[model samples]
Target chain A: MMSELHINLSESLKSKPASDALGFGKYFSDHMFIMDYSSEDGWHDARIIPYGPISLDPSAMVLHYGQEVFEGMKAYRTPLGEIAMFRPDMNLKRLNNSCERISIPQVDTEFVLEAIAQLVRIDQEWIPDGEENALYIRPFIIATEAALGVRASKQYMLMVILSPVGAYYPEGIHPVSIYVEEQYVRAVRGGTGEAKTSGNYASGIKAQEIAKTKGFSQVLWLDGKQHKYIEEVGSMNVFFKVNGEILTPALTGSILQGVTRDSVITLLREWGYTVVERVISIEELFEASRQGLLEEAFGTGTAAVISPIGSLSWGDKNTEISGGVTGELSQRLYDSITGIQRGKLADPFNWVYTVK
Target chain B: MMSELHINLSESLKSKPASDALGFGKYFSDHMFIMDYSSEDGWHDARIIPYGPISLDPSAMVLHYGQEVFEGMKAYRTPLGEIAMFRPDMNLKRLNNSCERISIPQVDTEFVLEAIAQLVRIDQEWIPDGEENALYIRPFIIATEAALGVRASKQYMLMVILSPVGAYYPEGIHPVSIYVEEQYVRAVRGGTGEAKTSGNYASGIKAQEIAKTKGFSQVLWLDGKQHKYIEEVGSMNVFFKVNGEILTPALTGSILQGVTRDSVITLLREWGYTVVERVISIEELFEASRQGLLEEAFGTGTAAVISPIGSLSWGDKNTEISGGVTGELSQRLYDSITGIQRGKLADPFNWVYTVK
Candidate 1:
């Protein structure tokens, strides 16, 4: 049985930003979902309260040890004037996986899902009505134990905050340039790379800043050991269409199992396309580009859904894929996935969850 | 030149605990040093304030991205009633190195040192008078921008908190058993292993937890790429003496450059011992143990100064080092370092910094 959820609504609401002016994660809704966890109490005091600053001890373990995990999902306003979520259960499950790796106690996924749904319902008007705009939900757990010891924290706080975001590609679907990072590695096997944790993102900031200076938007990471095989594109799982086959790097304990990546694979397989998951080296990819066999490449994630890769630069070599345009496959995947999410297309896979 | 520091003393201070009852990092002092940073003004607002909880926005990047770095040091009460710090300048310099890697802004070391001196001066009474008790200082910088973007935050908080800690070994310095961790990697060559960042420690907790369950006090980490070469012992740097030669892993971009490890190396070299810094494999160590050539091993860090290793368990093989007793070299080094730190021995190398 699900425990009771206490509600404390805010008396005053902040003015919402214009849908067109809403950038990514810039503004938060009026209310947020919060739950407390302790070794003795397990998890309790689930509630929705006014969004505000939190008071933490100076010696909180998360500030010193980085023992935290988070998940990202979106709540869309469907044409039927109802809110929809795309496979939020998968995100909660993945959050638990991250918690296990970070040594945090897990939460009941079903109960948390209900809490998220309730939060979205209370802040339903905050969902943007723009073409690609939606309410971005961020669920995170942080170690709150006020101790300086180097161990798992005894207390934690799990919170969910909502932000209405504008379109990833504000103008249109434009492919982005990617610099293949050689100096730094995102993660190695037996590391926290596969989890939706902050450390992985923190370490990638330097590489990302370097790529930005080089006029590229993101970096294509190679495997940590060999620095040969492709691991990921920025924070997204990468996919390539070579010769008529769809290929992506397998989940080898170093890259995130992206929810959109999984959905794309399922849709492709349902459409009679042969999809293969295995290690693909950068050299082979460049060789394919040289031979005109690399047709198109893109990254998959919840934020962008489908982000086309325009070009890749490794060492002294640069190759533009699909004439530096969004490929047919990339566009089709984006449209189909977004359509299903927004209730425009038939939900063949039953991937949409509606919030009452 | 240093900026003028503002000070706010607490009206009333809390009662102090008995020296013998003080455990490691269990109790904090009265005052703390804090400095704020913004892209617009750099690091400013340096002050000593009453130690208390800090208010942070729910979307502070540090809580979500783990963009933070920290340093650990101790202040000891000398036999002559003077407070002395061992190589504090080194800790401040290393903190800058960690800041650069984590993309946080650097603080003026001299200015920060003055701030620390002031805070320590205000809380000098909190430093315990027990045999092995002293004040432990933790200096950390955390991303404080209330934005949820993936990049580095535009604002940060650099603070130093003091904790009165007891001796690492309460009764005496006894050797500990270690398990060779082969499953989880602490860090890779291109990751944040060398930096004093929270992510490295966060990733190491699971392996340490596993080792503890098997009757080991710590886990000896191996290199990430091959998982064969030695890296670190728990959070400390490892050193081994075999066949009259000292061996420790080189500063190979994947292991922390420990201050204690450096001082020990200098001491050994000055005493006419040949210290080799190179990649030593676990296989070679096991082979030496089989041939009865392995003499002794220990881990070095600020907390313990010197932690002697009694035995090592690798897979199904367990070998006792120096008959599971503290080696003469380990004990001597501990005595020399702690003696110098406490102003009990001659400061030939001029390592101790006395806070006036």
Candidate 2:
């Protein structure tokens, strides 16, 4: 197996202690995993380099065309003082899917997992031990060719950078109010909505800023076709509890297939909950809220785990949901997921992969 | 006015005699104008730097989130060997509009013009002599902050890169085929379609590739809502000649307000053509094609002065336009615009501004 391939480590390494005040994505760990792919070279030259700036041509496609994709996952320092990642294989698969959609070469999943494991093992000292602190791993690929034409780049760079992240919510978790944006749509069918690409997130910044100005945590994106269906929250996959059943928007072509979103669905189903992935229109959500049938609503993602929605306001109309607090099911799901991540609870699905 | 900035020419700056091979955005010149903007200091340290690699943080927002905008214009070498720009103020105004939409700070229009003038004057040797070749200026702004969080960046870099571009068609202007993309939608209402952001072009790269694979020059993008209304053709604004009337899609908040589009409208109006900016649905276009009322269709942008559409393929249907050649009106409009730009005809509208 090529698993024993020598990893040329960068000489210029800057190591940081675990007790340092953790920020979101500012400071990086000493080493980063990199793998380059070309039409002839395929995938080769896998190495661990010091975290630093990347030199790019002024006409690199990523700078002008924004041809890039990224994945966000975390390596947790378990109660046993061992590093564990939650379903990293899912992230690898999803990253390949995104690459395929963008015409980028796909890396072998085994190679990616092994490389990530090696890097995390080397930087295990950077993973924090607190309740919410972990090593945030960002695996991203960018088109690196020095061409100005509007075509697929010949060369690409895939690198993984690790950042020590504190809790997404520094204080105790509180339900957040979201603004229902009727004006801006995040993704449309037959677009790059399903892919975790830079363009998708870049297009939503204006709407997100608008939502923040209107006293909301995030903007609930609607269907691009008619702006009627509840597509997703900007950075998270949305879930709704109606009639004592869990409901989420189906994996339509316009919505990202988030790994956390899928995990929640699987766990809820395994735990004896009616988890249905179907088109949940905004009208249905509002109507259910009016009838008190909507028990809870929350967004799920890697960042916040499960961020409960306290209320939703759209165009001067406001609706309170589930006593404006974390719902019973949401709390339970959060506990179960976090427990599995921290290696406190039994991972029945074998979702946690230990980094060796 | 701080117009006399330091010009640190790069060692790679070799004097290549201006050739007709300047094609669009290729073959950049020696020097580029650059200025930095920070939250503390609004905008300062304006200088002409050597065009070279830009070192960027791996997590820079522009590479990932695509917080970038750009403007495209050309400086023509007049018969008197003097450089002139066509409707530069319009480009500046449109750039500010793009900046406002993308949350980037707008620079002083006069200051930007002065900077461009200085750069053009310094690099006058790179400007081509023939009417077919001109110096294309690309003024772009990118978020340079090394943060990964989704927020407005406090630091930005604005630079104007100069490229000696040849004619769109060096041999001769030929009509091209375009594929009508019924599945993919480029922009929707209240989206960043009107703004010249990198995300907008990034989203179209996949569709462009598909169109190219199907033997088409570009993909005709449809509105995101219904996928019925014609929005644009690649990076250019589209126009249709239906029943002796020039029709273009109205600025419906989702289509780029192309400066070249506006100039064409004025030029056509002056030449006694009924130019109407209204919703031109795809159904009407197909119907007109069937009735032989569709005389010609063309795309307008800074890159290609006017690209004639010879044929359009939608789904399994194919329609020939104007006998697969540039139509009378298309040639007339092209001639008038190029004539005015190259100082071969009367400048009645005072559109050309000489850069002294």
Measured by lDDT, the strongest candidate is 1
Model 2: CA > 4 A from native: A1-20, B169-172
**Residues A266-343, candidate 1, lDDT per residue (tens digit)?**
999999989999999999999989999999999999888999999999999999999999999999999999999998
Model 1 residue B7 distance off true place after TM-score fit, in angstroms: 0.4
DockQ (C-alpha based) per candidate is: 0.86, 0.65
Q: Estimated TM-score per prediction?
A: 0.99, 0.96
Which candidate number would show the highest TM-score if scored against the true structure?
A: 1
State how far residue B282 of model 1 sits from its true place (Å): 0.4
lDDT of 2 by residue, B1-356 (tens): 65445667667667775485556566777888988899999777889877788888887878767788888898988887778898999999998998888888888888888898888888888887666788888888888888777777889988888888777655445789999998877777867888888777767877888898888989999888788889999888999999999999999998989888998999899889999999988888999999999999999988788989999988888899999999988888889888888777889999999988
Per-residue lDDT for A92 in model 1? 97
Docking class of 2: medium
Native-referenced DockQ of model 1: 0.86
